[model samples]
Each structure stands twice: as C-alpha cells, then as structure tokens.
Target: MKTMILTTALLALTAGSVSAQQVVRLATEGAYPPFNFINDAGQVDGFEIALFNELCTRAEVSCEWVTTDWDGMIPNLQSGNFDAIVAGMSITDERREVIDFTQNYYPPAFSAYAAMDPDADIEGGVVAAQTNTIQAAHVAETGATLLEYATPDEAVGAVRNGEADAVFSDSDYLKPVVDESGGAFVWLGEPVQLGDGIGMGLRKSDTELKATFDTAIQSMKDDGSLNALLTEWFGGDDAPQF
Candidate 1:
C-alpha cells in the first residue's frame, strides 16, 4: 500500500506549475488489485486508475501514469520522479512529516490475518505483511514476529509456503484472495482498523495541486459517484461511502 515502481506512459505536458497545462506524472504500485494493478493488457488498471483519470479530468489537468517500488516511493516523489502518488498509501503522521496528503480517497481499512490453519496463534505467531504498511506497523508491536515483504502477494505467499503463521493485510485486498483460494485460506481473527485512510501523497510545496485534487475528491463525495465507484470495485458489502 505504501510503494511501487514501474514504467511511464507518455501522455501530454506543459510543466511550469502543477495545473491543467502540465502532464502531471502520477505514480502507483500497480500490484494491488482492485486498488491499482497491472492488468492482463499490461497497463495500469484498477479503481484508483479510474478515479485518477476522473480526478485529472475534473481538475482539467493532463496526467501520465508511472509505477515505482513501494519502499522507495516517497523518496522518489521528493526527487521529482512524479508529481503525486495515487497509490493506496495510508495517511499517517510519520508520512506527513515528509509529504502532505489530500483528504482520504478511501476510508479507514480493516486489517486482518489470513491463514490456512484456522487455529493459528496470531497473537504470538509468525506474521507477514507488506513492508511500510499500517498492517506491518501493527504487527511490529504485537506478540507476533513480523516478516516484511516488498509486495502484498509475497506476504500472502509466506502463509501458503509455511514461512509464516499468517498474512496480515487490508481485508479488501485479502477478500478476493480468500474467495479464490477454494477453501484453503480463511480469515484468522478479528479485523483491526488501521490508518486514517488512503490518500494521494504530494510534496508540501505542491499546495495548488493538492487543492485541485482535494476539490475533485470532495466533488465526487458530494455527488455519490465516489461511493458508486467504491462499491463497483470493492463490493457493496465492504465499500465505505462519504
């Protein structure tokens, strides 16, 4: 949820300040399905991708999509590799010290443990989580030993391979996995709510750009389009509305 890196697709540009004239280069992990991922067509496609396209349209700005490694994402942003990160990054005080965030695009998420064994001791068991996520942060303070992976798939794989007792992650990301697991994987314990929610990460100096996207986000919220998109991607059972 915190990072990713990939190639850039050329679109349009102007580039003096972050406005309609400039082709704003936006970054995403392109690995988290339903949120952001590389589709079979080998293009970035997901709920966030659709939302970004809409936000850019609303802000009247042209944008190009890019992907980058999760761990290096924030640093890459500061280095000007992209204009903003639309990846599913949680809004937290630690991140705020280095970058600013617009109002949340996704609501606070429930993090849960998934394991093949229903009786797995999540309290003191070996647990895997994507590095830099709020799920990983929660695990680090628990009786469970934390194993951080660079990607969400790897964290889930740890449980399948017996490298960890369970995988902890955003339930939205985990739900589809479990459903597709054919009775092999099951949710392990009570879902834990973590982070303030998902938001776009921007440089502090990009105040104008932040304002632009924020206005677009609120407009979607007010119009019910945001909720419709959320349900479409994540399902009505779990998708939270404004």
Candidate 2:
C-alpha cells in the first residue's frame, strides 16, 4: 500500500487523556519512502516529516517525531505512546471506527500489482500485500490467494523472490521500484483506487489537536504551499495537488 499500509493488533485501549502537553509527539512508520522513511542520518525524513514540522510551526505547537513499527502503530497510539500517527495511513470507514483522522494530506492513490512476470495472475493467483491493508482486503475479495506481510518491503520481496505471483500495493511506492528494476519488475494489471486519502490519525478525544492541525493543513492549501510540498516530494504529475 502506497498511501495506506500495515495492520496493528487491537490491544485494549487505555483510558488515557491528553491536555495541553508541551511537546506534541508524532509517530511514523519510518519505512515508507517518499511518505516517511529513515534517512542516512538515522532520522525520520520524507514528505510527511516535512509536513509535520511545517504544520507544527504554522499551528504554533511544539512537536517531535517518534519512530514506531507499523504493525502495532494503532495500538501504540491508543495506549498513549504517541500523540498522533502520520505514516501514510489511509482514511477509511473501518479505520475511523478505531481512531479519528484529520482531513487528508495526501490524495487518494491507485493500488496496483507488480511482478517479475508480466502475465502474473492478479485475478486469482497468489497476490502479496501488507497485512491488514486495503490492498490485502481488496485482494481477498478479488478471489486471489493473499499473502500477507508485516511490511510493504516484505510484500515486494515476495514478488521478487517468486513467493508470490504479484504484489498489490500503492503505485507511488511501487512505481519507483518498477522504473528502477532494470526489467525485473513490471506492473501486472490496472490500478484500483482505495481509501479516501492519507491523513493524521489521532485518538478520538484529541479534537482540539485535530482542529489545530486541520486548520494548518488548510492554510497550506489556501496559500499554495501544500501543492508545492506535494510537488517537491511526489513530483508534480503524480501527486494530487490541493
């Protein structure tokens, strides 16, 4: 999943409440590139990192980054481990049942299939997807045998190593791989749009923080800064602007 990936166990939600904390801690997967990833400096870097900092500045809110594994991301947030999550997580109805999300920062993107073999059977063959992602859910409905991986990289690796016929994921993440694979990878079929878009996930009670960030995000869009940031990270053509 490009825009959305990973699934976390549903741990018991702690009845924790946040007030005007001095430092607003935000977490990211630190694995999804162009959205969020660890850099050579061992720091979280990418579009979302840049966006978080800028948004915090605009909102006059003190904030810091926290790196967390994607598989248990939701549970950690629910348990008061972080103030928010912005790790390319999608805004879906099912997810909304667990947590609240601000307006989308990234527009909806199509999920596609990629494989070493061009004729890979995406319709009913073995398909790889990140565990509990929209892609995996979609694959399950497509009548394909879904292979779930804890990380998107592992899902792609399944396709590369012949463990899966094709891997279904967000095209933004896979397009670069296919373009740079030297013919080792090719798209298997048409892409399908999933989720509304990507957004910041917060606990249901964090309405004030959500309103603050939402206002900041809308300001960026109003001032044309959001479009510029989108272009900088995802290129003008592929990334949807405000």
Candidate 3:
C-alpha cells in the first residue's frame, strides 16, 4: 500500500510539472502583409512571425504556428487549440473580456492612399481611414467616413484601381505596398488617431501563462534580440516599438 501511495504521489508531481511546461501553440492570420503574411515560398513570414520566434526562444517554450483566418483567430483561440496568439491583433476592450494581452509589439498607425489623379479632388487632407479600426472610429468622431475595406489588400487594390476614392490601412503595410506600386499611387501621410503597440493575446483563464509571456518579452526587449530580429525583417527605421 505504501509503495502504491508513493507511486501515485510521484505521478501527481510529474503531471504538475507537465502542466507547468505545457506546449505553447500560436495562431496568426497569414494574410496580413508585412505583419504575418504567406510569402511566395508558401511559408509564413514577416514581423509577427519573426517576433514570435524570438519570444518563444526567450520563454524557453516549444512552439508551433498555425495559419488561421482573421475572422476565426479569436474564436479558435478561445477553443483552446493554441496557448497564445501572436497575430497583429489590436488590444481592444472588446477583446480584453475574453483574453489578456501582453505588451504591444508594434505601434498603431493608419495611412490613406488613393490613385494619383489631379482631378479626383480628394477633399480630406492626408486622407482618412476606414470606419472599423480604432483609427476609423476617431475619424468618425470628426465626421469623416473612414473608408473601409474587406481586407487590407482590398484597400490597397482600391487605391491602385481607383474604385472607392481611397482606402486606409496599417502604415507598415502601406510602406511595402507603396514601394511595390512603383509610384502609381500616393500616400497622403496622415497619421490617424490610433495607439501604437500590438499585444500578445492569451486566454483569460491562463493568467500565469500571460505573466510568463510578459517576462519573456521584457527580457527580449532588454537584451536587444527583439530589435535585431525586427531590423532584419522590417528595417531598422521602421521596426515597431515594443
């Protein structure tokens, strides 16, 4: 009986340790360009991917990345398929009810773009964002219809094709797009009223895991590994501040 009791105790201890070292799975919308996008090589690349790699290494946790649709990322996260979310998800109050977020990894800025046409008479100075993002909401307070797009690329495409006056999206994405467009379009260069910083999302039930992630993030920030990786992916001047 004593031997059986000791075995049970050992098993309990082992299980406890395993629980502490649980595998961490991360999810992202592989469609957000310059953030987390599917590259021509059909592999995930960009700012969030590089950042997640550094974070996992510093946290001493093994990680796996799963591609998820933007609309489904939060729902899937709530289902327990992943331990954390590294997607470029804005840390908003609506999301805070369901998940806790770590320190933001990028700043929040919006840029408006429109096709180059002298007669277009785009009245809004520097352009305005869509109506959905926090920036858009700010634009709305000013009574401007922040142009909305189904996707970031759609917004870019609108400007490229001259469909909807103009479209607004994250500035990081706009930079690459503007370069790729080869001067066909013009960026209005208006910084929208939005907060900088992207957060790591964790299930509200996993407060301990959130704490672990924050510590890892702070360590990376202090040691410069995070900055090095950012410079490699986003260029030194454009890297988002942690």
Against the true structure, candidate 1 reaches a TM-score of: 0.93
Per-residue CA lDDT of candidate 1, range 127-234, in tens?
A: 999999889999999999999999999999999999999999999999998999998999988999988999999999999999889998999999989999999999
Predicted structure 3: lDDT: 0.63
Q: Which stretches of candidate 1 lie over 4 Å from their true place?
A: 1-17
> What order do you get sorting by lDDT, best first?
1, 2, 3
Model 2 accuracy (lDDT, Cα): 0.84
Worst 10 residues of 1 by lDDT: 8-17
lDDT of 1 at 224: 89
TM-scores of the candidates are 0.93, 0.90, 0.78
TM-score for predicted model 3 compared with the true structure = 0.78
lDDT for position 128 in model 1: 97
> Which ranges in model 3 have alpha carbons more than 4 Å from their true place?
1-21, 108-115, 118-132, 135-142
Per-residue lDDT of 201-222 in model 3, one digit per residue for the tens?
A: 8888887778777887788788
